[model samples]
Target: MSEPEEDLQEEQRDSTKKKKKKEKRSGKKKKQKEEREQEEAQQQVDEEEEERSECVVLRGIFKLGKKSHDVLLTRTRLTWIPITPETPTGEPCVLQPGVVLTAGRVRGEGEAAASGRPAVGGAVLGVALFCCRRRGRRLEEDTLHLHNASAEHTQTWYNTLKELLAGFSSRPRYLKVFINPSSHKKEAVHIYREHVAPLFKMADIRIDITVTERKGHALSVMKECKLDEYDGVVCVGGDGSVAELCHALVLRAQLDADSPEKPVKPVLPLGIIPAGSTDVVSCSVHGVRDPVTATLHIVLGHLQQVDMCSFLSQGQLVRFGFSAMFGFGGRSLARAEKKRWMPSSRRREYALVKTLARLRPEDCQLSFQPAKTSTGNLFEHRDEDQDVKQDPESEGEESWTTNQGLYLSISIMSIPCLSPHAPRGLAPNTSLANGSAALIAVGNTSRSEFIKHLKRYSSSSGQFSFSFVETHAVSAVRIRPSSLINWSEEESEEEGDSKTTPIIQSEGAAFPWNIDGELVEIANEVLVRVHPRLITLYGEEVDEAESTVSCSCI
Candidate 1:
């Protein structure tokens, strides 16, 4: 190597170096392109996974938009369903759980691929989101919202459906429904077959309907019903029927006093459906007289406890429930059996008017334990001051005058409202389970005084006003026709009503008693006590609507 040879060699070496560097840079660029493509493919796979995660199975209903449709709850039968969402819309859509659809109509897979989302799927999902757009997104377990719908509407639908679903989560409840066709208005059979049966079917309530044939039919049913076989006994009749049924239940032991030993019994829950002309029990308990309304209350499953009372006559059961009377009214009630053929409207107009017009004082000895002795017992208050003021001045204030004849109306009741006609019913302070019975005894007086006494019974003033009267709460009572006495006789002796041979009062005597509304001619004179938590009732307590009165003077 000469100088010229060295320059040419150096140039060749430079050229070779430049060629190697270019080859190295090209290899590195190719490697980077391959890595970027691989990264894009991996991202595409993850996006597909996220889309798949959105599909969910959701069961729901949607109201038809002015469209009447037949829904097949069972694949075989078509039910004409209401278009409104409130009426179990019956439009059930089973969506993939946790799938959130967008606010656009469902089209083809092309739009889904183009947008890289779930715009369409199976036939079911397609029908559900037909008018709206949908995509695969996580569906929340707590709430499933339909796209493009009103938010408030969606929430309302969800809550109702949730409750409906919750109701079905449990097994069906069997209920024994008792209907008295002879009760007030007498629509028991119709109510049971139409209103009550359908709802019970919807709610899966097993039912056994009994049509009462006579006045005491309901009482006999209550006495013989296998209470443990059912969750509750529902009465679809008037208050009188319910009273009869309840009375019979409460007096089970008393009715069987002559038997060996009282048999152990299971307590049954009582349900009421207002179907009678005077649906006092329904009005008092549920505050509504509609059978459907009452059935809804039963479905809600609320229970309450109410007190019961019994009336006894010399070793025989007469009547029970709230009211027990000894007066012209009692005689009238006994005669009401003859007027059963009269229509409810006629009976209502006639029963009260006739009883009032034909009223006559019947001499009787009415007595009960003082209110002070047994707090819950039916007692009487002798207004000495009022008695003295009303006494004739010529009588010279006879303190313990041997005998006097008079007409009287005795009423013993727990709740104030005796019938639906009297909504003000007993005072608001009254309690159905308070173990107290109010007694209103009206004694004989002048015709003007008798009318005034009747007015007092219905007066807004809760206190009784009378000359020879007593008003108090008691647990037990006794009544017998007074012995006939001659005013001409100088001396008076206790003379029994030998003509009728009235049963005499004595310890451990079985008396005819009436419990609830059914009159048992032989409810043996037996002990009657409150059984706490025995009667499981539904809706408002009887005492919740009592009238307020001032007892400060007591």
Candidate 2:
């Protein structure tokens, strides 16, 4: 072999080996880049999946009992993720806004209490009454405590939980309030600031308060209210305030419905802080006048629709009444109003005695349309058309019944009429939101009989079973004094001109109407119609079984 050929072949072999090495290095780099891209893509996918989780607003280590776990706090819930136990993470405990009553810091315990400095021990966060169902039909309450965090952080969690809880049941950023300073006890404004404002501040809610100076001031405020800027309306007073607010709001809704430039709006949800002579509406809705419970109910944004009785005369709405009583009850209320300015604690007793002394059965001409009670759900609300369809035969049928002699009292109640005055409620069988109102037409009876019937209300036995009283579930009622109507003239002629005495009195003698604890002017001819679910109140919704005893309040 020649020396030149050997050198060229050696050079060719060296260049080929270098080319192979370069190819191998390029392939290795490409593989590395592909693997890096794949890992990045997988990371992106994992983050996207986590986004679907109840996004962790706040997370930390929570010490529950002796065990510790990682925890997450959301707007409406708190979740625990255990770390050391080596157990599969399962469905987290849901702290429902409605069920979770309160969140606060726990007082020092054991060694922490023994120590002079509470900060030496870690802080604790506690939440009360986390209601859970074990057998699907029973309610179980549990309290949760999170320990081992710093004092400031624990407080922060508490405040955050409160803020989140407030946000859970409601989306109201601002509220419009009407406070009647002259109502019953006249502490409405004070009650509102003390009990209501703090919760609102914690919940980050803005309050626009109006202290009513005059009798009809609240009505005017509600009528001219700027509906867009408010989340809901709150009334701080008694039943009178509720009546005023409801009337104004319903009228506004009607006006908006008739307007061409604006859309008709739903009546804003309303909350009542009981601070009046009688707070039947509040008791019926909240089960109690507990300031904290009422405030929390409003903050949580719970709502229960209720029926309303609208009093109309001459084709115009005069007022909206949650409860009404005629005869001696009305007379008693009227007499009480006149004596209210006396300033004596015995004024009510004096008025009651005086009214009862001269009380007699009222001779009234009554006409009504019977409500459909076949479904056994007299408390359920139904539209007019639906009601008619359900009882087609009774649609246009009207029943006229006359109590020509006397009636001790006739109470028309939309709700159960639960109040401190009437503990078991005025109309115990009636549903608050049902389309029907109970007409408890109590006929004339002796004082002793009336007393027995009234005493029955204090117990759970009920007052309707008495022989002197009769009740009818009615959708609407038209009432006029038989002594003033043509029926009176017909009866007078039949009795002949020999006995010239009138039955009741002249048509000008207007009997006062006791409307929601307030005495109001009522004409001789008054028609009351029940508007089903006319107003929505901040309260809880119990099932039919629970509805009857929903208000165990004083």
Candidate 3:
């Protein structure tokens, strides 16, 4: 072979080898890129799953020697994550296992302010007969001070196996409960006995129940009961029961006092366990009136305090969880009561029939004092004393002043919503603990006008100004007909002329009045004052913002 042929062949082999090496490098790079992308995708999926499961519920009891503590909790709402083992100041030892829990709030200073000690949430973690501290440890010695973190050297054990519960959720500090059967409804007692008792077994509470025997018993009961005993009271019957309950609860505070010398406290709380013909409160508070879910809230120990108002007639007080109203429409309450003897299913139609027949302009006297310039203005004591030296005779006319008008009905409430059926409720500026009342009256004539007012009251669609409302706080009220007031001539005649209509005399006679949901014949005048923390309510201490916004207050 020639020298030229050998050189050409060698060059051809070198070029082919270079091409093969380049192809191998490209394939390897492609494979690496694909593997990198796969890993990134898997990592992204894992990250998403972790975020969804970021919530951790740790429940267990800490045992120091022979003593054990119970810890019941739902979730911790915090602004920052905590990493230290130190016990937060003012916060109780919630790390202990087997402790019963309820959703609660904790206030402390700085980090300590948010600690969960002095839990106001009305959650009962079973009965704690005693809480003894360790022999040498000085922790929990002062409830007002911040608790120190348990020393690592101190001996302690946690029991997490049996006490660790899963599937916990967040909840409120107050709840609404209804007792429907109350003897008048066949299933009210059964429902309470079978279901309500179990839920109560899991919470802390002071309950007020109204049992109706005759038809309007619930209404009369609601008109007379004290609202301070509960965070929320519920009705277990049908629509009429709810309506009557709401009607009585919606009456504005006529006087500050439940009793003359002692001012009344906040109106009781409201809730419903719908066993009635119609469950408006239930449907409104929650979209559905599921008994099991309602029972679950009690079991889970959720609580919230709501606002209410009081109405005064003569000198007696009537409290409203919703509104204080009058007019011929209030007769619907009496009619609904009379129809209770019929089947629950038929009560609605019968009530409508009675309402249509009895619809009329109920002539009443309405006197109102406009809402003060500010809430501070409600309390005369809180104002500047410009008249401390004024003549006593000049004060007489001001002290005995009164306003009067004619009306088909009058209603004032604490909440903006009533019965879940009516929208516009108590004055928006009112609060459960603010120590004031809303005064509303309807003077419209004819059934249509009365209904229009009723619709406006119930729909809550109005954007009313201060001019449309009369809000005030007073110690007494006087209600009487501006014109000729008539008692049922038929009912009065049966007792003969000697009865003299049992007139609500300005001097000596007792007038029938509603307190909370209970009814009673009270003395002609109701003297009211603010009740200072009369009953302990287990829930968040109402904040200024919430008190100013919605009517749900504690």
Candidate 4:
């Protein structure tokens, strides 16, 4: 064959390969185009569905700042889109219903109305939306102004917003307020007037205020007051005030049912305004200890049903509380109570220093009933014998676990007690309404090691990772403290030292217990049982909290 014939055959093969490669590339581009079109179509359908779910109550043209935009009001949100020449409907600025506090007409405004822009066609008519803007853990009030040229248009928007806000049934119309005048810094009244009253007035909520004169004044009011007229009860004080109100409300329900054994749930919800030093309950529920945030939670009608613990001594009702601490906690509080003349802050510091200087463990016996594997409603009151007979399959299993020894501190909490000192809470494993409580037992250890364990609560995690600490989820607990005189004498005799006296030496003396920040004295064993969803509070469950404050006493 000739060289020219071989070159012609090679050229023919190269042309055929190039044609097949070009066809494959074209087919790939066509398939990519088809996939892109399908994705776009699905996104459009999804947007349409979301719009349909949120029915638009009103839509019109309104000016935000200096720009003319299309505003839309829905049942759950208010949104506005910038209308520019390039993009007629630009990105929307959405305002959820939870953030909006109220709306009203704004007349004769300067910067608040269109950034000092004069009305183009007629007199300036504007509507202002009052909203609570959340920045991290704090909530600040802000205003969004929308102006239009027509007066009737602005009036229509204002009226519609007012009617929509009124339709929220969860929000309270009337509240029975009890203000304790002797809270931290004696500023409970001032905090309410400065930060809380104006918001309630703006929301048109009628409040019947009563300034408490004594420690149990709120309880007295709760006993005789008409619960039907008020939508809810508001406590403007510390955790003690909150605990007192809770006990009063629960007792009232029991009396109304004419059965102390079978107490019913409270008919009205309770709202707490933080005015105390350590606002543990307020911080746990609202995730912050700010008064405005608490009031906003009440105004927004956020509901959280919390578990409650009932303390009984000698088979008699003592009180209903959310959390309790014995040993060091009780002794410190008792010492603080003795120095009532001192300032609250100074009193707490003095008590803490004194207690730490004389840190000692108490001899106590603890018995707790572990929670069942499958969670059930704990609200229904049942006898222990009845529960045991009903579950015959678990006859061999032990229901209660007992532990007796010396302990520096023991804490039982139904809700995670979140505060500034403890960001993750003293009981980080427990939840708000989980039908169980967290039993934390700290065994005897050196003072330095114990302080290290206490200081770990403020960190992010690992607060209960110490060798002397133990945690369990329980439904009921019995705490019995040994006689102080008897235990001390026996120890001194064993050591052959007659000069050693008991830390708290008294005959027939009562044991001090810190329950929800209140000091209670009991001479015998106390049984604490958890009741799930016993009372509804005006706040949402908090998963995490941010703390900017720390304790320096350690």
**Where's the lowest-lDDT run of ten residues in candidate 3?**
134-143
Candidate 3, which segments miss by more than 4 Å at Cα? 1-180, 183-185, 193-260, 263-297, 300-303, 306-323, 343-364, 369-402, 423-434, 456-460, 463-477, 483-486, 489-554
What TM-score would you give candidate 1 relative to the actual structure? 0.54
What lDDT score belongs to each candidate, Candidate 1 first?
A: 0.48, 0.64, 0.39, 0.77
Residue lDDT tens for model 2, 322-434: 77887767777777766767653367677677755554566665556667652332333221211122222233565433333356788888888776556567787787776
Model 1 agreement with the true structure over 124-161: per-residue lDDT tens digits: 22112111111221011111113323445444433433
Off by over 4 Å in 2: 1-59, 63-69, 72-76, 79-169, 259-265, 343-345, 374-405, 484-503, 541-554
lDDT at position 540, candidate 1: 53
Tens digit of lDDT per residue, candidate 3, span 428-524?
A: 4454444345544434345444444444534444423222223354322334543333323123324323211222224443333323323334433
Per-prediction TM-score: 0.54, 0.67, 0.45, 0.78
What range of 10 consecutive residues in model 4 has the weakest lDDT sum? 106-115
Q: Order the numbered candidates by lDDT, best leading.
A: 4, 2, 1, 3
| Candidate maximizing TM-score | 4
Clashes of each: 65, 2, 88, 0
Q: Name the runs in model 1 displaced over 4 angstroms.
A: 1-172, 215-225, 248-266, 316-320, 370-407, 426-429, 456-459, 462-469, 483-534, 542-554
